[model samples]
Target chain A: MKRRLFLASSIAAALAGCSPIGTALNDNAGFHHALGLEGSLDAALMENLPGLAREYSIADISKNFPVDSLPTPTSVTYDRLLAHDFQSYTLAVVGAVERPLSLSLAQLQRMPQQTQITRHDCVEGWSAIGAWTGVPLRRILQFARPHRDARYAIFRCMDRDDQGTPYYESLDMAQAYQAQTLLALRLNGEAIRPDHGAPVRLRVPTQLGYKSAKWVREIQIVGSFAHLYGGKGGYWEDQGYEWYAGI
Target chain B: MQRLVYRYALLTRLAHWFGAIAVAVLISSGLQIFNAAPYLDAADRSTPTRRVLSIDSPADGIGRTTIFGHSFTTTGFLGWGSDGNGGEGARAFPGWLTIPAYQDLADGRRWHFFFAWIASLAWLSWLVSSAVKGNLAEMILRPSDLHKLWPMQAYYLRLRRDPPPHGSYNPLQKAAYTFVLLVLAPLILLTGLALSPGIDAIAHPLTMIFGGRQFARLWHFVGMLLFVGFVCVHIFQVLTQGFFNQMRSMISGWYRLREHESVGP
Candidate 1:
């Protein structure tokens, strides 16, 4: 009886100890700050190791690639663009640049195209491989002549999340210049479907799927997106997800 | 004669306790993370055909867990459970089983990664310390231990009158510790790294070794289950053998060997 009581007391103490840890960890600024530091360190170390994401063969493409964005943008602007086959759509390149320019779908398609098969890893722990064809984002950055002060490229999309906030994502200059970073126009030889970010989407294989902002309307180069949209850098990033979705 | 022997060293005790806390947090947070998807697919893409295990609540509000072709109603415990507010929600692992006891994937990931660092550092320190002290051999099962495995099992089963003569740990204990520390732990870490796209950018081969990224995720979950299994058996052993003595050894580094157990000079 004494031994059982001792065991019970010890377990109760251990459990009591655990509840404090949970309370201490939840929404703790210090822990979040530490996590951010770790993320930066991780990004720096990963930059040193092969800067390229492994590409797969065409045969490895997933037959049923899941669509991530829910409720598909139902805005009049999106519907109008979809009706017109995105012919009237113009991708504006603004902010921290020598020259702000607007390029149409036809103009973007005419640029140097890179076609590669790569895997898409979502933050929800699902993966899908698909072939994407598009113009390298660096070429567009070069065309616009980004100012030396530019540190991040913010991809603003037309789709609003559940709360009516516009979807946006950002990448550092280093990630923007990556060979695989594309303004993807085509998926699996066909023009991107409306549900899958029709006309254009940013394809960042190095980061998680959320970083690949779809239905991109503007590419705003900025010194820091900390001042823009919740100061966390992106829509999901503002909603408690890590700004650096590399993991 | 009952003898008091110095069993666990101070370093060992510290690492053990630290690891225990870190592991508990990691497991709970990890389950919370898994609750985001609540399905395991062997293929690269999580298609319906390849899904081996899944938990969900349909329009009926009844939670069900499906494994392969078999389905089980795990309502109120697994697929559907509450956060202690009497409001039963459709969460895979339930709130009580997770850190923060609520559906917050971001917080869960934060907790998971934070404790992961702690666990990894402790494991690294334990590894280096044990190697320096030349005490790693004590945890490793050897050819000589092969013969004692059956006798140890028989003793634990109460089929043998006398327990096997061992120093510090029995042969079975050595095997369990050997596998958990050397094989399982490192594999869990590696599989975890494979799930990260950042890590994949650097070490893509790590994902390929497990067939694919999705498979790596599956293997990582399996590794967590194995760790849970090991912990349950370990606690059971501690309770059966001598709870107070085992607890005292782990806490204060002194163990009281029973009268039947031989004592060294």
Candidate 2:
């Protein structure tokens, strides 16, 4: 009986860790795991593939059929959400919200906040530097008042691929409230631009770019991820994108 | 009685050949780009398999070709192509044509980038034309085909050996190819273009697709990893099934089953 109790306690801890607090460490974990198995296998091999060395082109983009946007200009990098025109935008917390707030850009900027200088890793094979400033997602969660049963937060965006379907993303609620997690309004000390989830974007710095859905227009807290578009939470999920975009 | 069915058209043949050459070059050179890896198995030199390449010969050839201060030179022998060209001939200078330019990645990059452009263009046109006429879509699996994938997957997992339902593509094959043609391929191209320094001035949209250069690199590498994973699985499937029939179908575009062959077994 005592042994069973210990096992039960440990299992509870594991489940709790799956929450936002646990998510902080586990988020963006994909990058650490996603950089490719070849890196540690050989350093000399990198010299041969010219296509991957410095730049890929439109022709290259067309070839991959799916890829990310260009690098953000250095000039516009920023520190806080309200510093730019973020106030002009609105944060729509929909889905299972008791009160789906269509918050304007200014409302988010005025909220209690946090700033983090974390690595934003991408699956495309590189990493970059940026200082993000935004309202703690926990603060927004309180405002959204997810019901006692919400299980996930699906991020819907204005961006679309060649197919014209709206791009969508999601995260388990456990990762939604990590202390470092934020709905960022500023990057590198400037207002977030349209290209980088202007107004507000989820900054699960521990996760991959795909996890950090850009140009987020709505936040939907849900009951379960299964059966969401394509039976996965994210837009790319339908097309075989990895669901746990940690790292 | 017997009429020749053009499985692969002339243009497609050209595309396939060039695509083969280009993809081969990209994958081969791609291993070189992953120099961050020290060894594959962490075993002795005898176990010889590079992390990315999976085969370990031609270290000398690869090592010799290094770049410093905008100059490309042969410092020593880095024998990468040895296994490719055959062990004996690889040791020999069968196709040893070295450029005497400075060994900047830019130099090797010229070939990779240009060839990548060519291959992508060819692939895109082929996909579009095929899609417009419904040929490509027909080849790919629909929801129904996906339902049939269980048996094929079972065959793959060693549950059964009844050859998968004969069609333009098995479910996994269609799914993999669709991703390659759609997701993985585009991911690589976008990241590739984003990484290009010179190409930006010519109306590049790397920043738009990804947030920035560093971000682009992160995404590009991930794409390559997926492709690598795909390549590994693809090779395994081909080997496990039958290389001759599978390879011929891809190359010739027509899969010939024996006269008495049926769907199952």
Candidate 3:
């Protein structure tokens, strides 16, 4: 009986090795600090290098580009806008800017356009390459004349997730103003599809796919994300994803 | 009579345990990350939603793992298992095999990258210290040891009864350790960096060297399997030779050499 009990306990202990003990360990402040270290390093490295994320050729485009499982926006306002083929859509630029503007989709399309084929890296360890055409975010930010103190550009989308949380993402000013950062109007030479963040989406080729939020409705320039929903900057960020997703 | 000797340095023992823990955490958390997109595809071409290897959980509650178009029901393990919350769920690896024992991709990534940093640093420190202490030279497979590899295997397999007097590490042990320390470690690190989009941005050539990011991921997974194989063999050897003596050497830098074993270096 004694030997049997010892064997049973040993097996239990071995099985417990796969438990959520690591999650509890992560609650410590030191682990939090260590977790942030790599993100800071990534941001610093990008700042120093400022190299372009690899751009693929037309032939390199993914044939069946995987779409994230984002549900179609079905709110009354979204349905109304969708019924009109997004012709009535306007992107509102607000907060910490010299001039807050609500620019129409036509106005955005009329602006000088930049096009590039770049790889889209999903956080889920998959990647796809596609061509995107849109105005550089820098031009729009310049037009708005963001305040020098404004540190982040928060993109609020029209979609609400399963938890009733509005889909949103943010980028630091440096990443926001990257040459490849775009408020994309087209994908693969065609108008964006509803399933793929139609009308307009943020295309950040350098960061993870989540950072490139789809169906972007508003761009809010802010000094800090402390006052945002969940006080964590973005929808996924609020759910514990790293805010700096350059990785 | 059994002889007690300082078989491992304090630094060596500490690094071994530290790296061992870090690697275990890394592998488990990595599987958690892998569960997020449980599919593998070609490196160059765009995958058509499905890939070479895909794990699917149909709405009918059957968990299927498909490899090369071959399907297998791997329920309660690979494709579906208990969620550690008294409910059944679909996930690539079982709950007990993952770090948090739950499905949280973000937290899994956190655990993975955190320990990845630790493991890399530990490996580098050990490499440098061992080299400085001339332990690295001692680990290399000498020409004389090459011929004895088969004999060592034969002895371990019980084909030969009497154990021959050997150095701190047997020929097979030296070869395996050298392969792991030199080849597998560097392969895993390089492939790991190749998986990072941030690193790819700054070091495109590095990713390309591995034949693209997808290939790099495949290589990284392969390297992990090799490491796991090495660990299994290592433990088996320890258990067979003398478990307590091996554990004591690792824990306290002192090992009780068997009577037939030659004196320690």
TM-score of candidate 2 to 2 decimals: 0.38
Give the higher-TM-score candidate: 1 or 2: 1
Best by lDDT: 1
lDDT of 2 at A42: 22
Docking class of 1: medium
Off by over 4 Å in 2: A1-67, A70-88, B1-265
Q: Kindly list the per-residue Cα lDDT of model 1 for residues A1-247, writing each as its tens digit.
A: 6887788678767754663467466658886677556556555666545557889998889987789875578999989999999999999999999999999999999988999898999988888999999999999999999999899999999999777888999998988988899999999999998888988998999889999889999999999998898998888788778877887
lDDT of 2 by residue, A112-229 (tens): 7677765454543344446678888888898778998998888877666665577788877766876666788887667866667666777765555667777777888889878776
lDDT by residue for model 3 (A1-247), tens: 5644564466457545645666566566787567757756656656545767898899889887788856989899999999998889999999999999999999999999999898898999899988999999999999999999999999999989887889999998888988899999999999989988989999988778899999999999999998989888888888888887777
Measured over all alpha carbons after superposition, the RMSD of each candidate to the real structure, in angstroms, is 2.3, 23.3, 2.9
**lDDT digits (tens) for residues B18-42 of candidate 2:** 7655665554334433322212221
After superposing candidate 1 on the true structure, give the runs of residues whose Cα lies further than 4 Å from its correct spot: A5-24, A27-37, B83-86, B260-265
Question: What is the C-alpha interface RMSD of model 3?
Answer: 3.0
- Ranking according to DockQ, highest score first: 1, 3, 2
